[model samples]
Target chain A: MAYSNKARDFFSNELKNINTAGTFKEERYIESPQGANINVEFPVGAKPKEVLNFCANNYLGLSSHPEVIEAAHQGLNERGYGMSSVRFICGTQDIHKELETKLTKFLGTEDTILFPSCMDANAGVFDVVLDKEDAMISDRLVHASIVDGMRLCKAQLYNYKHSNMDHLEEKLKETQNLRLRMIITDGVFSMDGDIAKLDEICDLAEKYDAMVMVDDSHATGFMGKNGRGTHEHCGVIGRIDIITTTLGKALGGASGGCVSGRKEIVDLCRQRARPYLFSNTMPPVIVAAANKVIDLISKTTDRRDKLEKNTKYFRDKMTAAGFDIREGVHPIVPIMLYNAKLAQDMARDLYEEGIYVIGFSFPVVPKGQARIRVQVSAAHEKEHLDKAIAAFTKIGAKYQILGKKKDEIIAQYGY
Target chain B: MSDDLKKLIIDYVKKEYLDDDSEEIDESTQLISSGIVDSFSMVALKTFLEKKFQISIPDEKATTEAFDSVNNMINLLKEFNVA
Candidate 1:
């Protein structure tokens, strides 16, 4: 088969434009497992260096936890490797049902259904439940998966300004005549570390006779007091109609997600959702590991508490050092740089100093909101945080990003 | 009224899309093609224009052809007799 010139030209031109725009995403090879410290190889064949990682989604530090590893190994030995079929056919296992039930209990939902990834779970939701007569009012800054999912549905879509309850209310009022109205938003926005006003949203939903959905990916394993998510944090756990979350982040840092909601919704998704109906079920090892993660978190609050402490300490230290940290209790802390090139430069400098972080600009966030999104995890100890702060102070002074003088920063932060 | 509408659109685009007042914007600048305004922002722009100008922009007319550039948006408003 030969390639068409039109297709070749279109792709090549697009790649060229991406490169020129400085938005070309390049992958860095990680030579070790995900954790607080990992070896990263920049260029192929180059020596990998162990850098303190601050960009991973390992909020609970279970990605490389000994118990998670042991559980995975045991699962692989007992359940074998892969389930060759989709869930309805032959892939449903005892562990899968156990994990789903555990998730339902944890999330305070009536039932749960697993997907290979949260993206898939999101992709499968709207089309199955909503139709042309229904209306979906989404947050403007909801995750990309939600946008893509909405595109597949026949529902009349309306987007309100990010986290603006007034705008949401206006949209809801406009959509009053629709057969079904649903409001969707991320529980904790990954970019700015801001939690959505779920309490207010629930109130509005009740007034507008609408249902509410939340994607709790960023808040799943370590957000609330018991780690139920933003709904629990906002005291709207049972009030929210639907909740979707991931095991790929704080759960075990592996790949799996679930939509936990009304039993009827889960039943319909199992019957009609394209992703769940067509895609293979989650592997036994991931299912077993996720189950172990839920069990561990259920038993004790050690990891979540550590993560909270780490987040507060890092956020406080960074802010007191004259860094403009986004105000949030979430583990994700965005250090605002405002300049795209400067953010890239700062991230590179931080990486060179053996502190691994990534800069997000443009398409990831709004323009002029370029930032280095630092994610704190329980794996990071006092020494790790101190080292990262010292490195940031040094680089901040070099780049003149610190609001005050170097002496002032040191004097204020005790760095 | 037309000039005011253009200024309003340009100012909103500058503040929301470009996010930099220092960048120059012209009537013929390619907003969608150049990635200055994305799909989400396009919807937002449509909603803003509809509310501000008191014109209903149907779903079919909310494409790059109708709203990609300032001149195109003005022409779209003119079609609705709101420009």
Candidate 2:
């Protein structure tokens, strides 16, 4: 009749074990709207401290943009609030349709279908397209959502090495026996901040007759010359088969995702994808605001341009400071601190110095690859970037890891 | 375990997942519990092993525990040999 102590004991022991292992996750609460700088209440109950944020996916700094907020309010006033039903059952508003159409044009895809989140889009996409006779070959370093999505389908699943085009080709060749071969990858590998060679991937897909899918969640808002995601950046527009991306990142930094690609695949998703069919439509305000975001970005690339400039500034300053960083033009800059405990400790120390960043270890990344992933936003001005860079330099020095080799850092920190 | 086969897996795991400074790996290394390879990534390794050895490791024998180390993976491969 009551919850059992036996089950409670198992969880309690597990928690204790995690604590002993120094991997217990502690969440830092943000007390203000997401932007370049925000108030974070760290260590749970401490007074909120304003810190220069460098860990948000607010790439284009539209999370709290005045125009986007005004758009949201205008939609709230005009379109009212929640959509109580699913899309097929009276939840389809004109604004929703408008956003999808605009997104199609913006993403260079023929059609688009909205989902509550990219996770839901991924979770529901695979099963609609693949069956037991087909096969799915994915990049091994793809997002966890893609991994979960692949599990839902009955297709033979294979993972090629991360970003190894030759290995992807090998998997493609191996899976050629199947009825259909689908290649899945992230447009930008989130952890590494590396861009996928979509140009090469598209060539492989063409040679092998495999369909290609890209989840451009990280690079959707501002990646190319025109800020049109990785397809445009890689010169492979109209070559990809299915693209699943998130509005939750740079596109207003709000919520909503979509499956945008050729008309037939999207048509299939609308008819069948479980998440879209069963779940209620996104709120009218989000839909309207997202439409405004698309219109703004379409009109000009100012915000994405600012973001690109900011990313270059931070990466250049940090690299010049002698920190071990993955060299890339992308905004996600990882400062490598090889030991797990060292990553956590450095993040805590950085928080003390008025910078908000998170340490990633183990499951979030791979083992022994602990890092402090700093995400630069268009919201960050010169002062904010300078402050964060200064804090990281101080913390890097305190840890004596500045310009140190990976072996030296591990020797001192001990993973 | 065959030294060459063990080296192949160690090399693959190191290059794919672990950093250059990852602690010394050997036949006794705990790949799963130590967080070097998660279950999903292990699936990639399974594909790699199957491709290299040209043997189909049954789903039941492909548990994370069975693929946790070079020794364990070697043991699992041994089952295919006997069969």
How would you encode candidate 1's per-residue C-alpha lDDT over A267-361 as one tens digit per residue?
99999999999999999999988989999999998999999999999999999998987798999999888677878989999999999999998
Model 1: per-residue Cα lDDT at residue A256: 87
Error at A250, model 2, angstroms: 0.5
Tell me the tens digit of each residue's lDDT in model 2 across A331-380.
99999997878898899899889888889988688777899999999999
Q: Please estimate how well model 2 matches the true structure, expressed as its whole-model Cα lDDT.
A: 0.90
lDDT of 1 at B59: 91
Model 1, docking class: acceptable
| Candidate 1, residue A139: lDDT | 86
Off by over 4 Å in 1: A4-6, A404-415, B1-37, B44-62, B77-83
Misplaced by over 4 Å in model 2 are B1-26, B34-36, B44-61, B74-83
**Position A191, candidate 1: lDDT:** 96
